[model samples]
Every structure is written in C-alpha cells, then in structure tokens.
Target: TPVLLPLSAAVNTYAVPANVLAAPFVPFITVPGTFAAVISTTLPWLAVPILWCCGLAAACLGLIGRAAAGFPQATAPWPEGWVGWGLVVLYVFAALVLAWGLVDRFRYWHMVLLAGAAAAMLALVLPVTALAPSRGLDHWRVALCDVGQGDMLVIRTQESAGVVVDAGEDPLLADQCLEKLGLDTVEALVLTHEHSDHYGGTAGVIEDRAPGTVLHAGSADWDVDAEVESVAELPASVPVYRPQAGEVFEFTRELRVRLTVWVAEAHHAEANDNSLVALFEIADPQLPVGQIGAVSHPLRLLAMGDMEEAATASLLRRDGVPPGVHLLKVAHHGAANGGTELLEATRPAAALIGVGQDNSYGHPSAEIIRTLEAVGASVYRTDLHGTVAFSLGPNGLEAMELR
Candidate 1:
C-alpha cells in the first residue's frame, strides 16, 4: 500500500491537467489482458513486441505533456498593488489546501479540487494579462506605430482626433493602425523629410480620409503624381505648406496641445540633413498612472527626423537645445549617425526608437541605446514592444505596449 501510494502520487505530480497520469497506468491494466488474449490466439509472439512499443510511446507522450504544462509564464506581466499580491497569495494557499484534500477523498471530488486550483490560478493572473486595460490608452496622448523600419507617430488632439507625424513605409499598416485607434481624420499630416520610409504611406493616409493640411520641410520638391500613383493624390487644394524654422503651428490651443517646427539652414549634401524637427508640448495633461489623486504636469516631446550629426548640431546652435525634454524620438531609425551629442543636449526622460525586427541596416545602434541608458533615460523600442505608446494626464504618466 505504501509503495502504491507513493507511486500514484509521483505519477500525479508529473501529470498535466492532473488526468494524463491515467494514460500510463490505464495501459498497464489493459495491455497485459489484451496481450494474453492475443497469445491464446494465433499471434502470440507479436503481442509482446506490440505491447512494448505502444506502451513506450504512450509513456513518452505523457512525460512530454507534463513538461509542457510545467513551463513558467515568461510574458505575463506582474500585477501591481496590494489587491494583486493578496490575490496571488490566496491562489497559492487554496491550491495547496485542495492538493492536500485530494489525498483523503479519492473520488470525482479529486477532479473538482484540481479544477478549483486551476480556477484560483486563473483568477490571480487574468488581471495581469488579458483582462488588464492598456495603461497608455486609458488616457491616450502619444502613440508611436510599429510600421517596420520606419516612423509613424500620432498625437491625440481630442477623443476621436489626432495629428499624424510621418506615414512610415507601409501604407496599409499605417492606415490600419489609425483605423484601430478610431481616428480617421487628422489635424494635419506632418512629413519630416522626403525619405520614402517617412512619407511612403502618404497614399494610405489620404486614401480614405484626407488631412486638413500636409506639412513638410522645403528641402526638395516631390513629384506628387509618382508619389501617390498607387493610391490617390494629395488634394490639389489641400494647402501643402513647407514650414520654416521658428514657425509655431498651433492646434487645440484651448486644450493646450501646441507644436513648433525647427529647421536648419546649413548647406546639405545628404538628403537626411534637411530633416524637419519639431517640439510637441502638452500643458498639464491628465495622467492616470499615479498612486495619488489626479496631478497636473506639462509634457515636452521632441521628434527628430532622419537628421544626421551636422543637421542636429545646427539645430542645437540655432535653438540652443531645450533641456528637461520628457520624450525624444530617436533619429534615423537608431542609425549610428544618430548623434549621441543630441541625446546629451536634450537630456530627455525617455527615448523612443521605431525600428523593425531583424532589420537589414542594424538600426537602433547598440551604442546609441547604451548612451541613452547612460544618460538615465528609459528606452522603449517598437522592435521589442511592437507599437509603443505614452499618456500623461492630471494623474501621472503611463507607458504601454499597444500590441
């Protein structure tokens, strides 16, 4: 009895769903009888080999199932607050009690206890996973899209309205992301530079709903027809403007969302030098991530186009580099050319990198990431988190992975 008890308990420990243990033991009872019947008939020698092979296969499969079931949660987020911790402790205690109860009562009650343990664990984890609300979307402010090897940022002007900065390389992806956000119309579509990656999705932006205006740097003239040949053309009267340095484009002044553009006048041999830079500030936004009551604080965000060292240095010289910027958009898809000097000058709290997974250019240079970290700035990359987003409100600031 002692040997049987320990053997049964050991088998149960490795069983997934607390039921797979039956598979190995059930064969022991049925196989011997079936083999005996076969031996009594014509195929006596074959019965032994067939039973051996089938039994081995079943035991292997059961062990595999146990290994799979025992895998720890790698992606699940840890829940916050006392309520969360209490729930976790409760689940562990209940599971232990149910497991102990199973030894005394060996009936359908054992299955009930196993199911109860499962329910307890589910109740503890659901709040940290699927049921949890997105921290950024709870008070949506800025969202950087995962457009793959490109940049696409959206700033919420109102509940159903936003301003798009760059359309990224894929038209369909940019369009779908906007659709998912429930924002069809934008205050304006701001193209930082003429690079296809930054403006290639212009067609998608204008295909379904056209922006109030199209803003770009007056570096080079683009052939409108060729650019939007696949989709639709920018409305002839859409009032395309080439914003100059020190130009403040005001939108939602009452709500306190303001934007100012900065351009460099230095002679540029490379196309990237002419990249347009901008500062987006939200005054005393409503933050929801704080432990205390709703607190009001301003947020300063800087968007760097694919501007190289020369252009960035020129920008710093002209504007004198703003200090204590809350967020920075890492320039040139995190290329090595993305100046560490610029990151140092701005001293932003967080750095956002919009690069693809396994990109050919090896974007988001490791050196740049290390520099940002050295500056005590938290770095969030689209490659790691998918679409990274942030929200700053009266309560506090919150960052989330939209995907």
Candidate 2:
C-alpha cells in the first residue's frame, strides 16, 4: 500500500497539471493508504480493535503536536531560496530519525542525542523567551505595560520615581517595565486585591529597590478570611498600609501630583468586587498633546483593579461616577460583567485594556470594546499595542512609541 501510494504520487506529479499535483497541502498520501490497507486486510473482529487503537494513537499524537505548537513564537518564518529547502530537508531528516527511534527501541546513543538536543533547544530558547517590556517613555506621566493578561500601571511621579499599581503576573516582566521607565525608586506599590495576577509580582517590584510604601487591600471583607499572602512576599523593610476610601497619597514630595483611591462601596463578598479602585489626579494645569485630544488636566487616570460586575455596580450606586475622568484602565480586562455604565458615566476620552493575545479567558470581550467606542473612547490594548504609554506634558497627553 505504501509503495503504491508513493508510486502513484510520483507518476501523478508528471502526468497531472502542475497546479493540480502541487496542491498546497502536506504530502500525507501514504499515511491514509497504509492505515486503510491494515484495516481492510485484518479480520472483522480484529479490525474494530485495530481501528480503535489506531484512532486513539492518532488522537494522542495530535494532542502532543498541539502542545508542542503552543510554545510562544514556535513557528519560524519561511526562509527564502535554497536556505528554505535546506531547512525543510533538515527538518524531514530529523523527524524521520525521531520516528525511527520511536518505531524501534531507541539505543543508549540515541537517548543521549535526544537529551542533548533538548538541552540545546532550552539553551537557545531560554534567553529569547524572557518576558521583557516592549518599550518605555521618558516623560510619560502614565504607562500601561503589556504584561500579558494582567495589570501593570505606572504613574510617573518623577524621572526616577513612580507609583506602580498591581504588578502583573510575571516578576521578570514587571521588573523590566519598571526599569525601562527609569524608575529607580518605586514610591508606592498598590495592590488592588488578593488575586495572583494582580499582586504576583510584588517580589519583583522590591527586588532591587524597595517601594516607599506597599499598599494592599488588607483583610478586606471579600478575601474569605484568607490572608493577602502577597504582602508577606514583600521586603521586610518596606511598610505596608491598608488604604481606605477618600485616602490621598503622593508619589513624591517634589512632584505636584496626587492619587485619591476611592473604594466607593463599603465592601463586597468577593475579592474582585472589593478591588481598591483609585483615581489619580495630576492638577498640573499644563495641557499636553494627547493622541485623541489635549490632556488639559495633565493626567486623570482611574486604576480600576480587577473589580467585577457586582463591585462596579456597588461603586456606581455609592458615588455615581467621578466627573471628568480622563483615562480608564478597563475593568476585568473588559469583561461584560459591569464596565459600560462606568465608561458612560465618566466618558473617558481613552480606555486601556491589559490583555494577552489569544488569551484562554477570552478577555477584552468584543462587547466591551464596542461599548468603549460607543461612549466615544479611543481604546488601547496591551495585546494589540505593546506597552502603550501616555505622556502628560506641556503639549498635552501624547501616546509614546519606541522609535
């Protein structure tokens, strides 16, 4: 069956039109023929079990292939000319060798070669796979890092100091972002809730330099009695504070900037609902040029932690909506839970969503994006634009990109 399939393929290549024979598909003609031959020739009773076994094996192989393909940047760009052909030949040879080892028991040398190849692969990939921020702006008053499905907002208090909100899931990513922003001093690290993604990178924030204050939603009603373990991970030297609604904090004494964290409602039953939502107001009176318009008030950023529907509703019911909210960090990665109302109430000129590309959770839902746009908001996403930064300067609020 295999010989016939190959022979037919070879003959057909010359007999048929080039377009017909050279269809854009994997040349898997032999696989189906071999399987059919085996299934057809076997006894009827044997055929059922054989088919089941083969199906199971195929399913498992497919799953393995899928898993391998899941690695970040796993696909390589097609090379040009003879280089591409050489790469294809090398891949085929390597695949055949691996298949042969699987068909026949692998020898000691084969096992050694396989182990060496795996180690070599790790060595080559590990360096490039580090989670580094795409870019940073020098004079930006606010920056939202592309932290991959988590929140990481930096409010620049000065050239060397800033307030970091909810250090994203990865420590390396958060650290790199802070470094890129030239933040030698993290004036404050505010953790909104106990969610791992929100506060997982606490250690990273304090790795080289300790934040002046580590603020967390300590023992909030929503935490279910579980301690905000993230605080325990912070540096012992740094002081931790639990901020209440109406509380105001400054990033640095030199900078004429302040942030008012308004935990509008009394409390909620879930962690996300009780997120320490804060409003950052920079009353600098200098209008900077923004992408959509001018940043008249310098900066008015609303860092909505991972607050969900119930909490959002509670906040709205308690305080309505803060007037003249300039920028909004879209809640729950733009989940349909409850952000449209707030978006409408504030009518923020710009909206930022921290999300990962092709995320499993299906974040930044299409409905939310439409809602933001409907409310006349210029939406920016971390997944779409890596490390989107807005600078509030004399010109206005300007979106910064790496040159």
Candidate 3:
C-alpha cells in the first residue's frame, strides 16, 4: 500500500478502516447480484428477492464510502509522477530490509533505527513533493489550470497577482491552482458565463485572496441574477460588472494589458452561446532595452469561453475576428460546435483546450484538432498536457506543460 501511494490522486487516511468495514458488504452484493442476474432469465420471482437484498447491501457499502470521504483531510494530497514513485520504492525497500534485520537480530536499537529511518524518509519527501507544482512558474504569463472538464485560465498581472478567467467546477482544485501559482490577489475575476463548470469554483478563487472586481455575462434572456446570487461567495465589497460587446477594460496602471469584450450578448437559445468572449492584449515584458527597429508586439490571447458555432459566426459578422492571435482558448472545451471558421480566421500560433480526461462529452473533437493543425496552430489540451502555460520568449511565445 505504501509502495503504491504515489500512483493515487490522494491518500485517504481512513481508507484501511473503510475497506475493512466494506469488505463484508462487497460479497453480500456481488455474489447475490451475480446469482440474481443468471437466474432472472429463468426464475424471475427468486431473482427479485435476491436482487433486493443485493441493492440493500450496495446501499450500505455506498454509505460507508461516502462517510469515509466526508471526513476532513480524508484525501491527503500526494506527489505525482516518477519522482514520487521512486521515493516510495526507496522508502519501502529500506523499511523492508530494516524489518528483516530486526527479526533476525532482535536488538532494541534496531527498532529505534527503523522508526528514525521512516520519519526521515517522510520528512525529506513531503516538503519537496508539496513544492513541486510551484516550481518553474516564474516565467509563466498565462496558465491554463487542469481543473477537469472545466476552464480556469490565469493571466499574470504582477509577481503575485493575476486576472483569472473561469474558476472551473471544483473549489479545492481551483484554490490549489491559484495557491500553487502564488497569487495573493485576483485583479479581476471573469466568470465568462453563468454555467456551473465555469463559475462553480468562484468561492475557491476568492477565498483568502484580495479580489478586485468580477466581470460576468448577465444577458436579459437568461436568469443570470438568480445564478449570481446563488454563489453567495463573493464579498459585498467586490463590485460586479456586466460589460457589453466592444467595451474595453485596461490594466495600464501596473501591467500593459487591455481586455476587449467581443461577445457578451445572447445570440442563440443555448446558454453556452451567450459565453463572454474577450481578447486580452498583453505587452511583451521580455523585450531587450533600446533594441533599434525591434518592434515588441503585445501578445494577443482570444478567450472564447464556451461560445459555440452560431455565436462565433455571429461574432465574426458583428465584429470581425482579430488577426495575429498569439494564443486561442478553444471554445466549448473543443466541442464540434466550437466551429473552425474562427480558428481559420485567427490562425493563432498556439491553441489551448481545457477538458477532462475520459470525459463523457467527447470534448476536443478530432475535427477541431484537424482544423487547428491545418491552420498551423499548436494544440495543447488540459487532459493531455495537464496544466499548460505560455510566456513571451526571446524569439517568440514559449509553452510549458506541467503534467
């Protein structure tokens, strides 16, 4: 169990006890459920009673699992990848050898040695693993956090401040991403739309942080008022704005960044079509001093929220797509409805798709990938690359994938 710890998403403190409690219930359901399935074709009456008993047992097992999961710190974070795996292997090997030595020699000092070795291993590994996510983040200007089937994009404003777009679904995941980025203040929180996947984690992003303002989509067609109130997470002091299309928000006081609202109105009946599309123009911060005739162009990032094909087409007609986009945040998690017209029009150098691994929606459709490839755009997905980040390099845009 210790050896396999690194491979798990989290370590459940009560897992051992929970398994022990659920062990008896497993057979009570499985055995009868199997028998019930086999006999249902021939003897329906007998199968019914057995199936009912199995259902009751399954319910009890579920209750046990839920209760265990509800406990505080039930799922403790663990180090991921090869580093963690290697350390676990080393620790297990040392412990096993020490245990064998104690059994063979039976010395009082050997027990003390084993205990000391275990403590040392944990002390050495835990701190290093905990700090892993924050490493190499200094150069990152934009980060697409891996929040699973949702969107959370952080654009750096200052050393410890950023403008967050879409908070994702899980509060813990959202909070962890911001914490890992070392962002103490959110200059602006952009809830692209009222969708749960995009705004459900608002509480996490604002918790223990200085939030300046919130920019959201509040169309007349949708009951956005109720949805906004439902959050109940935002502080009363924080102001909320529902900006219209073409409205520009500048951050020139500190960072040379301008956010232009592209689409804020509802074009289609679907809620996703009303997603708040914004274009972020961030000036290159890495330009060399007094370079003659060297033009430093601001990196343009088009965050398309979840706007589908119809809305995108409408946006193109109403206000044409911005050319020379450095980064494109793929819409609708790269669903088929995301449309290829905008991809072709923008022809961004890099495209990012925020979607979960093995998602039910079959996001980031093969068609979308093919379109991006056709337009010579490098595609990065959260499901495949984990957390993807971009920064202005000496030559051009540099991408870093934290898996």
Model 2 steric clash pairs? 288-395, 288-396, 288-397, 289-395, 289-396, 289-397, 290-397
**lDDT values for all models:** 0.71, 0.67, 0.80
**In model 1, how many backbone clashes occur?**
9
Clashing pairs in 1: 285-393, 285-394, 286-393, 286-394, 287-393, 287-394, 287-395, 287-396, 295-394
Model 2 residue runs over 4 Å out of place are 1-136, 218-233, 264-266, 285-298, 393-395
Arrange candidates, best TM-score first: 1, 3, 2
lDDT of 2 by residue, 184-283 (tens): 8888888888777887776667777678887777334544123334333555577777777899886545455677878833356665776788888764
Model 1: per-residue lDDT, tens digit, 41-63? 67868676767766776677666
Superior candidate under TM-score, 2 versus 3: 3
| After superposition, candidate 3 runs with Cα above 4 Å error | 1-135, 221-225, 289-296
Q: Using lDDT as the measure, which candidate wins?
A: 3
Ranking by lDDT: 3, 1, 2
Give TM per candidate. 0.66, 0.61, 0.64
Better model by TM-score: candidate 1 vs candidate 2: 1
